[model samples]
Target chain A: MIKQISKPPLAIDDSAVDATLVKRVQGGDVRALGDLYARYSVMVQKAVVRTMPRISDADREDLVHDVFLSLLKLVNKFDRARVFRPWLYGVAIKKTQNFRRKRSVRALLLRQRATNSEDNPVHPPADGQLENAEIMEKGLSSLPAGQKDVLILHAVEGFKGEEIAEILEIEINTVWSRLHRARKTMLQLLENEREEPGGHENGV
Target chain B: MVCKYLYKYLDGRLDWEDRRLFEDHLAHCPACLQQTSDWQQILTVAASLDNKDVGARVAPPSSLDVQRFETMARKRIEHLGRLSFLGRPLAVAIAAAVLLGIAIGVWKNEAPDTPHVAAPAAVSSRVAPHKSDTSGAPSQSLSEAPLVSPSATDVHFDTKVKELTGSETLHASAHNGQCAHMGPDTLCLFPKSRAEVMVSDKAHVVALQSGSAVFYVQPNETREFRVTTPLGTVVVVGTRFSVTVTPEHMLQVVVKKGTVRVEGDNEAAMVQKGAVARIVSEKSGIVTRLATWDELAAFSVLSKMIEEVPAKPLHLKSAKKPVVHDAHQLQDTAQAQSLKMLDTWRKEMIAGDVDGAIEGLLRYLQAHPNDVDARFLLATCHKRKGHPKEALALYQQLAQHQTLSVANRAAYLAGDVCIKQLSNPQCALQYFTPFLDHSGRDAPQRGEALYYKAEALLQLGQKKEATQILESVVHTFGRTGIGQRARNRLREIQP
Candidate 1:
């Protein structure tokens, strides 16, 4: 007879070093807060770049700096026991979202101006060094925000679904479902491109 | 049972009982067996897509940018320091003036018979209970204290006291001070004298204070090491190998060359070429073992490549060759009948008639109660129809038998069903624990048993316990998909 399978166990424990550093920062040690920022800035930057590629390099650095400064303001309210990586990523995700929205507005305005003009029409910036990056940016922008967030956090950032849930304040199952859907959609999009003549030439 | 546990089986999330039931069903039910093959194909497709590069790229931060950012950070800290000292006094002055104005108002409003207006003492006492008890009293005195002890006098006394205690504490802790930070592909080593160990969600700190010690760190992993000996603090990256310390407070190191470096006492050495170094207490060290490859590879964390070794080839002996019999005469009647039953059930299942399939299998089992095939097929049908509880009961029955091959399969299926379908990790544990308990050396399912057991542990929130099980699987199975999965899960949990 086919035997009934059982589910695996789940474990939870507070990370001690994370807890200590977070506690110190919350306790008003600016140096501890700075140390925390220095530690996670690269990871946060990578996650942001994956999501917000269109942002200028200078602007990306500024965004990263602003995230730390914003985090500094809220350090006193952050929970010491909770893992800080996901929380910081969540903040970075929000910052990236804000940056995208501002860019979108600017693009919309530019399009409107081009449409109103009789002779001059605004063209998109040449692909240049960011051609592949632009395609990825466009693909990500096309995804639903929730799905995009889950995909970036899980696939690109190498976080587990459970960690993504903690960062996004969602259920673990939600993370899984979003990841599944996002992967399916990305596959479908890639397949569509593959069917087009010369699409493979673009090195996706 | 097979149907019920299919999802769990596919996800590799099944507990023991369900996994057993699913396997039992698969052994007997050809239709469910085919379904598993289809599921495997789907997984292959999914994995391929996941591995495909989608053009998300990253360029490393330029060295120039790092320099500029560090300079800016230093300036910001200096500016904040100046602001903090100057801002605090102005804040206190404003607070004092507000308090004085309030006190004047209260004195002016006091009636002839009013009970002394309590001289702000009763008001302060009443407010103390409402505010934070720790900081409330000190803040209340901010206005009163500055009037008695001017800011300059208090600042001088505070500085003197701080200098006396800070210098002593600094010297005591300075010996073992080491700080290390790890990013995705970079390990940053700071001076041991100024380093303080702090571990966050993305980083780890290990204090290695002995004169010599060996540490084996695995790749895609980061560990902060603090060394207090004369040669300085050494930070290493990647896994596999050990470090040994000498009695003279020098570090003798050997690395299989993932990445290793010694930083301290105004000197740094990058130990490449799988070399060994004898770092003297005060002098720059010499690196040896450069002629031949370092022996540290053996000590390195075994890679996932180890698990890929195929099962040992089945041995065939000539001495006990089977006597040939006529095909019709040799076929066991019971076995033939069971085969016919499986055929009919498979046809019914293929026709999309699950009830017919289940009924046929159940009758076959009723006639031959010990017919393992029929029993397993029935359980699988029930499982596919979403009857996990029933599948569990059936798989549990077969898993207890002395038949090693059949029992092991049943146990694995049972674990799968419990984990995937019902999402009951606890129930899954019941089935998986036994399989692990009984698996012997060289059993094909032994590695699988440990892996599933760990999965069950993980689902149940017993992470540390699960980590031990996963570690065992990695040690045993090495390069197999199961071992790779275990390693991946370990990374997820460790940091």
Candidate 2:
């Protein structure tokens, strides 16, 4: 494993690094695959969590590797004119979507809730935060699929309207409309939870 | 009353008139104003998934997860890569072209990548001047050919050292664009140039297989230093010289100091200091002349190489070996320093304090689980402490290590313990398989892997498999000490 050492701050563009690594990977350079994984894994993992909140840890881990494996075979289709991060995230989202669609009903029903909270690097949903996290998961899952995607890409991933538009491959106006409706529905869900008699909700 | 423009306004998408209407409504409508605050709060909670102010709700993949993903992904790529490369129509055509090229070379009575050693007496006479015999050199044109290893056995160091078989280099990198150090020899490579260096008891060999490199070899009487190009070999006792493979793939040797025997085809040229030797196949024989300014410019990096060995270590060893202390006791004051404590623990091990060493090693591994050397030492401590199972487990973990030598060593040690300590030959086979799987034919542990695998096979009542493996050991590595042992075993088994 290449330990990421703390180094002198250099103004290196990430896009250039990604482009170089992608080209090298397309040429069958394995180290570049490792490098490309190292750079974007954290972002992809976060996206995985937001995309598939209920995915079993083992399944999630497999899903993550599957995304990269798909990239290894499919990256040739990535346009040089497009940015790599959005392209890679697009791959991750599609893999997750496919994983969701293909997994058996019995498997979904038997999905194990993670017991090793200590091992989880994610901030555990605790106290009032637990309700919000649950609500976020429930609310997002309940939304129209397109609206849910736009909301997650905008609010959770912190992508701009333009980047989300490019990633979702939709018009910028469609992204805004979806994001608007998604946020409104989610806000209504949270407000109803807050107003339900027991009202000492944690402020934003 | 619900305001339709509230969310759009938050998104910075509302037009000027719409923004006015939204603010105009919010000015009097407390319900809409409070609703906007609620939306802001909810979005804050949502954004907290990514925001660092509140701990990020979604953690990225852990380092271990990243490692697993990398390993699995690389395996998939490798599997597909092999299939794709072989599956290509172009691959077949290229292979045929290469075969045809080799056939033509053989038809023309030329040997490629084979340098004949010159006896000292005939070294001068046998090498006819410019118009003479050039026998061993490859007659095929290398003008468009990519530089590759001469062969598996006599392979040179290239940038792809990670996957390359054998212990070829101590350290290799294009440091500051030119010079790279391999032990005492400093190789200053021309930009984008390639070379391979191997140091062993018998020979210090370098294949300047492509581009050019200025080699400064410090003289050692015990070993012969030989540099090979695709076209020829330059044997020197001690020398500062530059070897270049030109665009036409001709061998150009410029010697700045000492004498070098340059051999190409069947001809040899004894190039002295300040001389240049050119070997353009047997037809051109060997030409000697004064070095040009450009040929001498290759030595400019020699001044860069003049710096002393670094006074301080630039980085800590990733796998630090425990240092044994002879007399001094480990102080409690220094116990807080885990790595130093590791040294004291090592001293304790040497002093037969097995429990103390185990205790310290366990603690050390708890802190630095990835340190394979420390883990190996801990395994040794465990084995000495008579816990074969514990030691075996640690060695099994160590076998997965990325360092080729360490992985091979771990597998070999694990197999030995399984057979000798635990008397489990089947388990021994399990451990030995990794050594064989990862080791290339030229890999240092390839012989040991085979030898141990054969031993396990024999113990498992698979004499046929054992015999075949033993025969392979004899056939593939018959020159080595392991081969001799394998041959002796074969004799006992057959007779």
Candidate 3:
């Protein structure tokens, strides 16, 4: 037999720890919920900030709290066979979507439905950020809803096509197409803004 | 310039061979290379956007917020309660019962030895009248009490805070004197009083801005009832008391039923029951003394402010504008100004203006004859003015007609007049018997009632029974002045 070089056993599986914590949470141990919050609060908060960049600090913090509350209330409904991180990540995304949906309704009520990102009065870009990032943020707001979701999941969340497909419950091909459309639209909008300032307000 | 596999390659849907083909195509096509470079910049933007400190854009973390979250989650879990064996209808019923049980438990824990003492604000006239215990049954002792809160007449604290986090700081102010029953007891504010009252799991604090406030604090081991003033602070572990800031910059703390510590000007003193503490200018330190008759008379009605719960629902006849139909708010605030009348009378009584105060009460009683507290205060002023017949008449009427606490007090006062003023020992026995045979430890004036009962017994020539009762008072309250007087009485009778 070939010489078997023994390597240290692989690092402990995080899922096992998560499973134990989840079991404790299901058994109504709120301390376990606290533990889960301590572990993943920063991650959930990061996802919220990235998704809603112009969100006020209070709104983002409340959104993070809402995500954890949903997890605390619905931990029993979680499928144990799956990984906890992505499931929580999925929870984070869904809650953010729900929040955005409500925010959109409020915006509509105020008659501030802005088709152009730069013209949007409800969420203005704050001072002191990368110039290119601000332009990208404006351009991203102009993209179609489906393409924007897929693009954020792929590029920002660092999920591959298959994972994005799983998280968003879309076909792999659909994820590819939407992201392609998102890039094309973003690039065109950025170019128009550079060439002619007010010409991009009409939207793609 | 547009390549078919460009997005597939960008989104990682392309195989290695296809990626190789795409790279080959990119190498050949200058237009596609520019397009790919532009797309890469967007990807870079997305990559750098991940976890940017963004701290400036968000609120900082707070431990209090975390605690509130934990409390809210606990309440949510209470909502998501479990039921396995019971059927659906029974489960619903059981769940409702469980919620009610939790509410009652919270009520009992907050109000340990106290009974429901008054009626709700809306219908006190129809409700409280029927509850007057005119039946001649002997009052049961506290140990044997069922520990039941008479639910029908009282506004349950649990229901008031069911929709809230139950830890909010209530900011209450009154241009005129206003009385409100919060939690287990009532807080009555003197005219022009302003206070921030916060009763929470963490602490019970009343930050007094101006005027005087009386607190009948529920006994709690975890937190002290603190009244902070500009001159000094009065701290009570758990008791009923009052705090006033004098215009001369002296802080007066009067303790009716508990010990309080007064702190100011780098001086502090512990004030016990039936005493007062004066926090004067820095040089005098804090002086503790037995409450004078005037101070006691002024603050005594405040401790009994709990009886004011249904005294009036507060209709401000002073409202300048007409009704808006849903003038519930108007009603609540309207009656707050009316309490200024009582405050005026109270000030007059303290200043030895008994006739003026009695006239004010007579006027107020004409419009609202059923007001128990005003009527009782009127009787007290009559006694102070040496009108024993008038005081006795009012006290007997209130004893037979008023609610539990005021009625108990009336009976005790009636007994006092018979012994000290009228010297009618037989009349004293009728009034003193009800107060003496009381089972509950919450019975007010128990020591004095017992002492006077002994005096009445001796007057009737029951010397042996009188001696035994006097001995018991000396044994129980030896540290108090009443106990010293009982010892003196005991010695004179035995020899």
TM per candidate, chain B: 0.35, 0.31, 0.35
Best by lDDT: 2
Pick the TM-score winner. 1
lDDT (tens digit, per residue) of candidate 1 on B238-269: 21223444334234555432234444444344
Better of 1 and 2 by TM-score: 1
Full candidate order by DockQ, most accurate first: 2, 3, 1
- Docking quality tier of model 1: incorrect
Tell me the tens digit of each residue's lDDT in model 3 across B1-495: 327777777777775446556755553342354456567657655444432333234343333454466566666666766422111111010000000000000000111132222211211121111111211221122113211222212222111211112333332232334545444433554433345455544344555543344443333323334555544556543334555434342456666443444565454454555577766553456677765434444443332233333432323344332222123432332243245466567657744578988977887798679987688779878986889889999989987863555566677879988988889888888998886664245233577778888888999999999999899989887865457667778777776
How much is A166 displaced in model 1, in angstroms? 4.5
TM agreement with the true structure for every prediction: 0.36, 0.31, 0.29
Could you give the candidate ranking by TM-score, starting with the highest? 1, 2, 3
lDDT of 2 by residue, A1-204 (tens): 122322211112345445655665666655456556655666776667656666666676667667777777787888766778887887787788777776645456779543444444554444544465567656755789898678767765667688888877899999988987887687767655643322223233
- Output the lDDT of residue B494, model 2: 80
Query: Model 2: runs farther than 4 Å from truth?
Result: A1-13, A49-51, A105-145, A183-204, B1-40, B48-68, B83-495
Q: List residue ranges in candidate 1 displaced over 4 A.
A: A1-15, A27-39, A102-148, A166-173, A182-204, B1-211, B214-226, B234-495
**lDDT over C-alpha atoms for residue A154 of model 1:** 58
lDDT score for candidate 2 against the true structure: 0.56
